[model samples]
Target: MSDAAIHPTAIVGQHARIGKGVKIGPYCIVGDKVILHDNVELVSHVVIDGNTEVGAGSRIFPFASVGLQPQDLKYHGENSRLVIGERCTIREGATLNPGTEGGGMLTKIGNDCLIMASAHVAHDAIIGNNVIMANYVGIAGHCQVGDNVIFGGNCVVHQFTRVGAHAFIGAHSMVDGDVIPYGMAVGNRAVLTGLNLVGLKRRKFDREEIHKLRAAYRMIFASEGTLRERVEDAAELFKGNALVQDVVAFIAAASDRPILLPRNGPTLD
Candidate 1:
C-alpha cells in the first residue's frame, strides 16, 4: 500500500494487497481481503469490500461498490468472491456483488469490459470479455454472458440466463431465456429476432460468412416443425461455417431454459 499512490483521505485496510502504480483517490474505502493489481485506479468515493480481486489497469469511478455481499437471501456469510480482469471500467453508481454458496461462490468479470453507470451485476454473474453493459442494465444472479456481447440500456436479464457470444440485446428488453451466439433479441420477455448482421459487419465478419449465418438462422427458426428438427436441419445444411457450428452447439447445449426464437416468419432480412 505504501508503494501505491493512495490519497491520504482514503481508508485502505491493512490486509489489502495494493499493487504497484495503483491509485486510490479521495474518500475510497477498501476492505481487508481485496487485491488491486497494477495500475488500478479508484476515482473517488469508491467502496470495495469482501473477497475481491481487481486485475491490472481497471478503473473504478465514484460511488461504485465492488465485491460486496450478495443480495440473495440464501447467501448466509459464505466467503464468496468477485474476480474482475484487466482494463475494465466500473462506472459511477454501479453495484457488483460477490457470489453465493449455491451459485458457486464466485462472480467473474472478464477483461476490457465497460460496466456503465447505474448498472447492477448481481451475485454469481459471469460477464465475458469485451462486454458492454449500458446504463441501467440489470444482470441477475447466475447469468452467463459471453464475449463481445452488447446489452442496450434499461434491459434486465433474469437469473440463470445464458447469452452467448456476439449476441445483442436491444434496449428496454427483458431476457428470461437463453439467447444463442450471434443472435439478436429484443422484447419484454425477449425473443430471438435475428442474426446480429450489423454487429457482424462492424466486427468485420466476411460477407460470405454473414450470408451463411443468415441462411442458417432462417433454417433453424423456420415455422412448421419442432425446434430440434429445425436445428438438426440447419446443422446438416451449414456444417461448413464455424459460426453456424457455434450457434448449433449453443442450441444443443441449452438446459431447462427456453431458447429465444424469431417471432415472425422472415423479419431478419
Candidate 2:
C-alpha cells in the first residue's frame, strides 16, 4: 500500500506522484503531472495544476491555486513548470502560476519561503530562499526576488523588476524598478528610502558592517554626476565591505529596468 494518506474526497490523478508521508486533505485536486515530495501537506481545497513539483516538508493551506496555467495570453499551453523548494508555507488563497515559454518555462521558488495569504506570484517569477511575502502581495511576471527579502502587505512589483537580497518593500508600495541589495524601499512608486537596518541587525550583521554599508549608501545616492559614476565611486571606496560590495556589484550589472534610488536624502539609523 502507498505510504501517502490521501483523503477520499480529494481527487489525485493517476499519473501524479505522491511521495512518502504526503497528505492530501479533503477536496484537494492534484493534476496529472504534479509531484508532491515527502512530508508535503495539502490542506483542503488546494489545487496543484500543470507540471508542478513541490519539495519536501512544504505545507500548503486551503484555497491556494498553485502551479496553475499562466494568465498571459501568450501562453499557448506549453509544457511549463512550477517548482517549489523545501519547507515552504503557502498560506490561504495564494496563487502561483507556471512560467511561459518566453520566460524560460519555469517559475521557481527557493526553500523556506513564507508566502502569505492571497499573494500572487505571476508567470516566470523567481523567488529566492527565505523570502517573505505578506498578505495580498502581487509579483508581476518575470520579477526576480532575491534571498531573505521581505515584502509587506498589498505591495505590487511590476513586471521585469528585480528586488535584491535583504531588501524590504513596505506595505502598499508599487515597485516599478530594481531594488539594490539591502535596500529598503517604500512609497506608492517605491523609492529606496534607506538600508534595511532592522532586518540586517536581526540577521546578526555586525555594527561595523552596518556602519560601512550606511556610508556606502550615502555616497551611492548623493546628488552626483550620474548614477553610474556614483556606483563606481562607492565600489572603489567601500571595496573592503562585503555588504557594500554586493550593492555595488548589483548596480554594475545591466538591467532592463532602472534601479530604485533613495528619495529626498539618506536615511540612517
Model 2 / residue 13 / CA error / Å: 0.8
Q: What is the lDDT of residue 253 in candidate 2?
A: 76
Tens-place lDDT per residue, model 1, 1-269, is 66799899999998999999999999999999999999999999999999999999999999999998889999899999999999999999999999999999999999999999999999999999999999999999999999999999999999999999999999999998899999999999898888888889999999998888988887888886988898888889888999999999988886456888777764676
Alpha-carbon deviation at 108 in model 2, angstroms: 0.6
- The CA root-mean-square deviation of candidate 2, after full C-alpha superposition on the true structure, stands at 1.0
Q: Candidate 2 residues 142-221, lDDT tens each?
A: 99989999999999999989999999999999999999999999998889899999999999999999999999898888
Off by over 4 Å in 2: none
Off by over 4 Å in 1: none
